[model samples]
Target: MILKRLILIAIVVLFSCSHTVKGQAPDAVKKTFQAKYPEENDPDWHKDDHGYYEANFKIDGIKYRADFNADGTWVETETSIDEDDLPDAIKKVIKEKFDDEKITEVEKVESATKGLFYDVEFKRKGKNKDVEFRADGTILN
Candidate 1:
């Protein structure tokens, strides 16, 4: 009897998770997202155990991610950016500090805790370097 009960519980848990991932979010969540970013098309959705939804999509050939809470509230967005898209302050720092290093990738991060920042990755020879900088070119790491 105990074994049967355990199997039933397992099945229920699995069923909930089955609809929680891979472009599957509640109608309400989708509605909220649609209203917010009407221009975004065909966003891939994912749900977490803690009632968070994440959307991964691209805009203008640049990749972006937007997260929402269970209530469909926008959490934050992270967008992949090009070296040319970086701000003048950031460009200045990179040019002065890492002139020889090649910028491999850059990301623009926007969050509640840490407003906005740039995550830049540089490559020198075979080694890779990661650094975060504030909008005004203050290197955090």
Candidate 2:
């Protein structure tokens, strides 16, 4: 009985300590997000690993995720895109190098520090790998 009670308590604590908390973002963060995405009335907010606020919202039927600093500074925004929508330069690289791997996900990332890039996720032999590339087909990572 004691062990079961301990397990229950642990489960409760773990759930309560989850990083993502809906509608708990600070006012500054929300305001920043609002200014950037005026059309989105409400965006589900979560705390990221870097302590930044992450807002998940949709625009024009496309899902987007935007990050903001505590003091309302815009950090980055990312949106998923179809594989065929990728730039031709990026497509050529994928065809030459990553053809063997299955494309799992793709995102167009615009970062304040890193500028614009594409993030492509690939799965091979049960392992997933993410690679960042510039629009001109230059690999960032």
Off by over 4 Å in 2: 1-10, 124-127
Q: Residue 61 of model 1: what lDDT?
A: 74
CA error at residue 60 for candidate 2, angstroms = 1.5
Error of 2 at 77 (Å): 0.7
Which 10 consecutive residues of model 1 have the lowest summed lDDT? Answer: 18-27
lDDT of each: 0.82, 0.92
TM-score of each: 0.62, 0.86
lDDT of 1 by residue, 40-121 (tens): 8589887655567888887777788877877777777889887898899999999899988878889998875678999999
- Model 2 scores a C-alpha lDDT of 0.92
Local lDDT at 63 for model 1: 81
lDDT for each residue of candidate 2 in 1-141, tens digit (9 for 90 to 100): 999999999999887666786798888888888888899988988888788899999989999999999898999999999999999999999999988879999999999999999999998676789999999999998
